[model samples]
Target: MSGETIYKGNKKILGLTTLSFFLTFVVWFNMAPFTSTIKEALNLSKEEIGVLMSINIALTIPARIIIGMLVDRFGPRKVYSSLLIVMSIPCFIFAFGTSFMQLFIARAFLGIIGAGFVIGIRMVSEWFPAKQVGLAEGIYGGWGNFGSAAAAFTLPTIALFIGGENGWRYAIALSGLLCLIYGFVYYRSVQDTPSGKVYERPKRNGAMEVTSYKSMAGLIFMTLPLYGILGLLTWKLSNTSLINSSLANTIYVILAVIYLYNVYKIWNVNKEHLKEGVDKKEQYSFRQVAILDFAYLITFGSELAVVSMLPMFFEETFELNIAQAGMVAASFAFMNLVARPGGGWLSDKFGRKKTLMILLLCLSVAYMGMSQINSSWPLVLAIILTMTCSFFVQAGEGSVFAMVPLVKKRLTGQVAGMVGAYGNVGGVLFLTVLSFVNPSLFFMTIGVAALLCFIASLFLKEPDTAEHSSIVVQDKAGKEAAM
Candidate 1:
């Protein structure tokens, strides 16, 4: 197909996939708007409310990894639809659950829906060529991510319109129902790829395949932080009284065993390929994946952490009312609509490595500047700094994923999963840091992390794509290739 024809035909599929992802996020974060209502209804303590907030993201880290593998195995069409339909069960349960345990269990399961982001990464890469995939993926990511903001803005008023003690419950359940119906619509509306195209499948499935034993070791080393972050979350649960100390200790031991078992699985999957060595044409550095992991940890990860705390930061630092503070803090997330896609377009115009390096360096500097904000600073200036810092942070995220699918076409799901999980790891760790320090130190810590990521980006090798086509086509050129 010609490039113009391809763009026209595939535009519909892109819209459908982005809409599916947007609805999933709408359900994933539906709980946030009703926090106050839920707290009042349940007569819960502040600590319990905090635990519920934390629970919403607890399952997402591992879910992304598992979902990534599933996307590669079953294709995004089936996986995305299935996830949407199945997660509705938990969404409805959280909406109407009466007890703390009920709400906790429901919210934890609902976290799996956050993995919807990875499925679309593979789907969009299939529809768009390598040259256009960055901006395409950026649109998928940026617009779909707006579901959270949409939920924040709309759900509360929706509940108010419905009116009554059950108003919030009904509002949330309505979103669940809509998402559930859209799951089937999405399944019928979209295919895995364009007509006559064969979807690429990885030869090995259970664990990620690494070409070299050195990369294999790096993969194992990187896996530790996923489990470590989970452990940190467990400790947070214990402190919040959501679980007893005994139960928390038991869970930690189980997590350790799971980590070791996972190590064995990684070895089992890659040992054969590593021992004999792979074909020269097929080999790619695993270090690229590792660097992107840290890159996302600081970028998207800090974005999550900051979004949660920024409202409070504004309220306290500038002595603004809750509404004013929320509006000002919202400038950070609001940047997603443009900044993320702009980052990807920059990567497409310039080189991917150069764009990512520049974004991370600016991100580091922006955060360092943010660390110096205080009551003495003008409120308008602080808001400007916040939005400016946010642009680099989100743009850095777009740049990271711009290279994820380029790593290994078949392993894109798993690669995206690992990199995406580290984003959450950054969130859990950074939030833990916030628990002990003030806002200034929190910003400084993230500044330092972004600087470290900037250093690591120096080692990222640009994908050698001299042999590939620069435009969309149907044959081998259609395969997800590096740039």
Candidate 2:
């Protein structure tokens, strides 16, 4: 019940949940390093490869929203476990994928697994008290996010050891094995919260409930990016530089209809709740969620996009070997363990708004350093820029989640899902931008986005009280609660 004891409980469960959540991400992006072999095996065109990469993230647009609801309804245990075991099937299928469509389908299914991060957001909230939740959530995010880097390090080596033209298959299969094992271990070892921690379930099922018409409009406005990012995916498919025009057109139509239908569905589901008379229930201010979403879109989103491309930038510019490039690029993620937790701790000791602004300013300077890179520059200087960029990149990540749990209690998972998805949305958006621009522009674009986030943070209202009293549905969880 005490803050320190609650954090101890949170730390224990977050550590375990982070393991499960991370495996899905590891296997999700495993294709990055192995794409060359896959393209050769399938005799695929460059356009097909682009489409293949795009498909891997295609389904996650809807999956995050749905998984958030499910975690809120059923708790993260069943959802997280089932996600792992189920994702492994695709990992294996992808390993042996003989045709382009086969790999595409498998990768698309894998996208849903990214939503695994959201479920743990709520789980972490239940275990930690308000004051410490930011640092707790940062650990969940920073550690779990490293799974991608793990895939970068170990997966290719596993493929090489298998020793064949089809070595990539062995690598992917090894990832599948990890998924299968972690699934059971997570299910068996972890509880949604400590035995003494309370689990809060949200009041409604379909969409986020808003307290007033003005906020409802704001909610609608916020969802526009979720759909717009999906539209970007469709546009990539249709682009002649990427995929076949005919198929892209079909996919575009499908995506457009899906977005429209999602808006309609969420509007209908929450229509009654949106009415002022239905409930005077207040959620986190629309402004807060919006600010956080933009912050994450810049911070986490930049990390995702930059990481995806860093290896290539190094290899081409400095003429480093692929392995060397990957190692250097991956040093950015190394900051995750310390920087993310440091961000949260700083926000707790200082103030959330001040901490976020400082990090955002640091990020702007970091981008300036990154933009200066050229073939003539010393490699050490480049590494310093990367490490410097990484500190702000990860510290900003820490600050965002530090604010997440304090919003509304029960909806932490959904809130986290939207924010997390925006990170992916940022990935898709920034990557798409890369398709049009140069690498320097890439760094500059992120710098501009971070500046926007800095301005947005000024609009955020800090939580003045320890708890925001919203109705938490008392089920079996209430009995176990230390609170």
Candidate 3:
């Protein structure tokens, strides 16, 4: 298809997919806006509340990987629709949950919805060509990611409008209802690919395929950290007395076994390719994926941690009321609407590698400036600084995914999934650092991490659009046909 024709055809698909992703995030984070209400109503301890919060994100790491595989095999339209519809069940359960255990189980199940972001990565890549993909993905990500902030801003008013002690429950349920309805709407509205274009699938389903022995080894090494992060989470729960020692030990063993199983799958998936070696045209470096993973780890990860803490930081540092503090903290998230898209536009207009390197450098500098904020600083100046830092952080995220779809066309889902998971890993790691340190120190830690990512990003090779097609097409015989 011509660029103009493809652009016109994909407008509807982009709108629907972005909306679907927004709703999924709303449902996924529904509990956050009502945490205080739920705690008081259920008479939960602080530790229990902490556990509930942690559970909301715990499953998402592995879910992204599994959902990536599903999307690649079944197509994003079917898998995403199914995910939205099925996840609403848990949302409803959590909305009406009367006990801690019920809420725990529901939140854990709802974590899968967080994987919805991965679906749109593959979907947007399929629809847009390399020349335009960065901007398209930036729009999808920046706009869709605004859902969490939307939930935070709107759900409170929604609860007040319902006007009862159980109003929070109703507000939460409304998000689920929207999700259920949108599932059908999305399934009817979008196609997996443009007309006459074939959707490529990976040769194996269980694991990502690698091109060479070294790439295979790198893949395995990277996979280990995911399981390790889960282990760290379990250890934290045990240390807090959230789980018994025996249970924690059991979970650790299970995680180890799963890691071994994943290693085996990685070997199985790439063994033949390692022996025969893939064609130069077909092979892309796993190192590219790794660098993106680290890049996202700092960009999106710090975004998550900062958003969670910024409200309190503002309140304590500036002596502002809860309302004022929350408003200021929100500016960080609200930047997604423009900042993320701007990053993508820059990536498309300039070079991807240069855009990312510059953004990462600015990200580090922004955080370093943030680390110096204190009560002495003017409130307006602080807010401005916060928003400035947020721009680079989110734009860095835009730049990272802008290149993700270009890595390996068929494995785009899995690659996006792993990189997306590392973003969460960064969130967990940074937040954990916050638990033990002061706010200023926490910000500095993030700044330092961004600096390291910037250094690593120097090695990123820009995508050669002249040499590689943005989309991969296959013939009926399972051979690469066109791009």
Candidate 4:
């Protein structure tokens, strides 16, 4: 579709999908804004509160991977709508829970909704061509991501408006209700692709299809780190006495088994291709996907970690009140509204590889500057530095996905899924680093990681946009046709 046609013809789809993503995020992060209130009401310890927060993200690591496959198999429209509808159950459970276990189980279940972001990656890609996809995906992502800030800004006021100790409960439940209703609206409003276009399904659904044996090895090597991050999370919980040594060991064993099973799936899917070799035109490098994975790990990972801690960092460093600190910290997230789309626009105008490398370099430098902030620095200067850093960080995220759809059309959902999962892996890894070091050191760690990703991004191969192909077609007699 032409750019103007997209605005006129596909605008409704874009609007509805973006709103669906926004509502899912609101439900996914509903608890974060009211953590203190919940902690007070339950008489929970700091360790218990930490577990509750950790539980919010734990399942998302795997959920993104699973949802990616589902999107590819069932199509984004159905998968996304089903996710929102089903996840609302946990949201309601968490809203009413009076005990720690109830709250913990419900919060963990809510993590499944976090996978909603990957679904729209495929949906927006289906609607927009390679030339326009970066900007389209950026708008979907940048606007949808604002849901977290929306919850933070409005949910507390909503609770106050309800006026009672159970006010937080009602406010949380309201998000669930909105999510439940929007699920139906989204199902009715959107289709998997534009008119007369066939949705491409991956030949093998369980694991990504790699082009070569070397790439297969790289994919396996990369998969290990995801499991390692889970292991680290388990260790962290064990260290905090959240679980016993025996349970941690059992979880470790489970992860190892899952990893082995994934390897089998990868082999099962790609073994035939390894023997016969894929068509040169059909093959793309897994190295490109790996580099993007690392880039997102640093960009989105730091964003999640910084957003979680920046308010406290401001409060501690500037001796500002909690309210002032929170408002200042919020500027980081607020940058997503424009900066992400700007990054995507730059990627489309310039070359994708060049745009990504520049953003990563700027991100590394911005974080380095942030590492030097202290009590003596002006508060205005601190906020400026934070927002400046945020722009590059979020824009880097936009650039990463700008190329995602271009990688392999059929595997776009799975590719987006694995890359998106790495983002959560980065969050868990960076936040764990924060637990060991002070704020300044934590900032330095992120800066160092970004610098490394910049070097890795130098190896990325730009997606070929010389000719855009339509999806495979089927004839009336069940014969396959190429576009």
Best by TM-score: 3
Q: Which ten-residue region of model 3 has the weakest summed lDDT?
A: 466-475
Instruction: Tell me the tens digit of each residue's lDDT in model 2 across 1-483.
Output: 444553455556877888886787798889988888888889999888888888888778678888988888888988898889988998899889999888888888988888888888888777766667678778888888888878877888988888888888888888888889888888887777654445677777778766666766777788888877777777766665655678777776877787677677667867776653553345457677778888988888898899889999999999999889988877888889888988887877787778988998789778866877899999888988899899998999999888877777777778888888888899999998998898998898888778777877888888642554221333464443323
| lDDT minimum window of 10 residues, candidate 1 | 464-473
Candidate 2 achieves a global lDDT of 0.80
TM-score of candidate 4 on Cα atoms, chains taken together:
0.96
Tens digits of per-residue lDDT for model 3, 98-155 = 9999999999999999999999999998888888889999999999999998898899
lDDT of 4 by residue, 203-321 (tens): 88789889999999999999998898889989999987679999999999999999999999998999997899789888889999899899989989999999989989999999999
lDDT of each: 0.88, 0.80, 0.90, 0.90
lDDT of candidate 1? Answer: 0.88
Please give the distance, in angstroms, between residue 473's alpha carbon in candidate 1 and its true position after superposition: 9.0
In candidate 4, which residue pairs get closer than 3 Å at backbone N, Cα or C atoms, i.e. clash? none
How high is the lDDT of residue 102 in model 3?
A: 95
Which residue runs of candidate 4 sit more than 4 Å off their true CA positions? 1-8, 469-483
Per-residue lDDT, model 1, residue 84, is 92
For model 4, where is the 10-residue window of minimal lDDT? 1-10
TM-score per prediction, in order, is 0.96, 0.91, 0.97, 0.96
Please report the candidate that would top lDDT against the real structure: 3
* Candidate 3 wrong stretches, greater than 4 Å: 470-483
RMSD of each: 2.5, 2.9, 1.8, 1.9
